[model samples]
Target: MSKRIFITGIGVISAIGKNASETLSSIKTASSGVGEIQYLQTVHKGKFPLCEVKYDNTQLCELANIDPKTRITRTSLLGIIAAQEAWRSAGSPVLGDGRTGVFSGNTVGGMDKTEHFYADFMQDAQSGDIKTMLSHECAESTERIADSLGATGMVSTISTACSSAANTIMLGARMIKHGLLDRAIVGGVDALTKFTVNGFNVLQILDEEYSQPFDENRRGLNLGEGAGFIVLEAEGIAKEEHILAELVGYANSNDAFHQTASSPDGTGAFLAMKGALDVAQIEPSQIDYINVHGTGTPNNDLSEGFAMQRLFGENIPKFSSTKAFTGHTLGASGGVEAVLSVLALQNKIIYPNLRFKTPIAALGGKMIPETALLENQDLTYILSNSFGFGGNTSSLVFKAYK
Candidate 1:
């Protein structure tokens, strides 16, 4: 039997604030969280803007309830922080009769601690702890998060560059709709490290200034680090409890155009958005808001703008990228931005697209600037898009819960 999917709870820890409440406040004020790196040690510490979490490793461990001596990866710590809030917010579901699962997405998994200790182990094979005790594999993050929540049904991680988490959420919804699981926890995490920093720098895509997605002056993306999670419950289970919203539609497609760059026409992106609309059974005109995967890279902005033009044209819904507020969190970016999308639908608040001065000449449309929280227009449905490297593209449709 086909099942309905609804989001019962959401939890987030971004550079803007510690939890969802603070992030909403920061968004309302149009303030920024991007600044010089403070917590993580990187050679580009002060050279580029970054969205770093406020808590140190110790503080995170305390909140996650992990032993101080246990060496959990930075990404795992982030997942734990977000999962705690999400499960708690979901009224901490009771699993006497229903099956529950967890799906997490991560790209740079456990690299922070691994890089920190790699040389130490290599240099002194006989001197100290091998430090291979931590789950350095990408799937390890998903396992740790699932075990933390006692989610014993199913668990996995997706690592399609940036679209990983969005795809994870999409999969969870499918599992429920297909009656595979009654409830699922879906999100992602990635920590800032020298590896990613230098990788982007080497690709010549790291923006020195605040990332301006869909802006003409967009230089590149500012790398960020954080985590976010959402509790997706079957409709029957969700109606049993009052919650935030619903998962209406989602889609994924690969352009297969280029490895690191999207097709000039954004074919894969357009397909994902169109597929989401199809799943929602919603016409493009019904969408109230759009949370774009605006990475601020010249190629992404142009390609995404072109896709938007093709999708919604002049009547495009209100949309913005939260990246300017919380630098690109890479693997965590999808889930982090998904939480932001649900916020807009639930609060009727449209976060300003920071740093947008002029619309791209390619799209030739007036960009939606930062707007104050408007009165809720009875928002019924929302479309959130996430695209990644390797031509991976995905979109989610979150509907307002009854």
Candidate 2:
């Protein structure tokens, strides 16, 4: 039998909150971090709403305990901050013993800094700071995070669009089960950049106001930036008292339906969710709650809703999308949502899908998401979905540690 994987520690820095405690507090009050653009220097500042981490690069460096003069990208800083928190939370395990690994997922990966470099270099070939381009690869942030934690084992980075972080977590669990490592620090991070913001704008999928996920009048997604990390250990390796939740099942699938849109029938989403359930050896009805990848886009919500209907039939469990709270964190969405899912299992609270109004009419208006916070209930099995562009979809089943 394969060893079970348990989540011992979690850390997140998003618009909703900087860490787990703050994130839980915001969930309790149904507060949303989606607001006016403040930190990102973008042309559509006043027009588009973004969920930023509410800190400048210098402040973030201070929080990450790194020297401000160090040439680092915002992505690396965010990853270091969250990864360190997760490491310390896991009792500061002795790393670099070749038994610990780091797996991170990200898409933009230092493009924020590269955008600045290219602009200046275009004007005067030697005008831009060459050092800014050092951390330009997706693996750079992952390497910096691994170095910060002193991990010398297998280190890898996944960049499968929005499903990146979920895949990383799945890979960590598989590695542990396969005896490749005893433990792993897994998550993802992405910093806001002009390139991403303008790219989404050109696609006409960015909502000017707060996103209304699962609602009939949903416009589109609001882009955001942040990082989230979790420490995973084999069942025998993690202390019982520190175990937060068990990663019971996980799976990844692709529909190849479109380059950026999910298939109307949600074939990829259904396959991913079903495969996870099969891995967990549980029925669809066993899922107590679902953290749907409701990106607030019409195509995404409709496709995801149909997928849930196909899997759960008429008895779909209570579900909601926290993206309305943090906006869509792009590559970090899975990691951020995974952290939230673990917290939900531990606390037995379901976060409300903020700003939800009407259900989709196509689903016969029956697919209403949990709009209000539900507290003090039995929540044993929870499923978190992360569907990304190019039809890449992933799901994770997290069960409360009995």
Assess each prediction's global lDDT (C-alpha) against the native: 0.85, 0.93
Clashing pairs in 1: 352-370
Look at candidate 2 and give me any clashing residue pairs.
none
lDDT of 2 by residue, 7-86 (tens): 99999999988888888898888889899999988889899899999889999999999999889999999899888888
In each prediction, how many residue pairs overlap at the backbone (N, C-alpha, C within less than 3 A)? 1, 0
217 Cα displacement, candidate 2 (Å):
0.2
True lDDT of residue 362, candidate 2: 92
- Candidate 1 scores a C-alpha RMSD against the true structure in Å of 1.7
| Root-mean-square deviation of Cα positions for candidate 2 versus the true structure, in angstroms | 0.8
Cα deviation at 58, candidate 2, in Å, is: 0.7
The lDDT of model 1 is 0.85
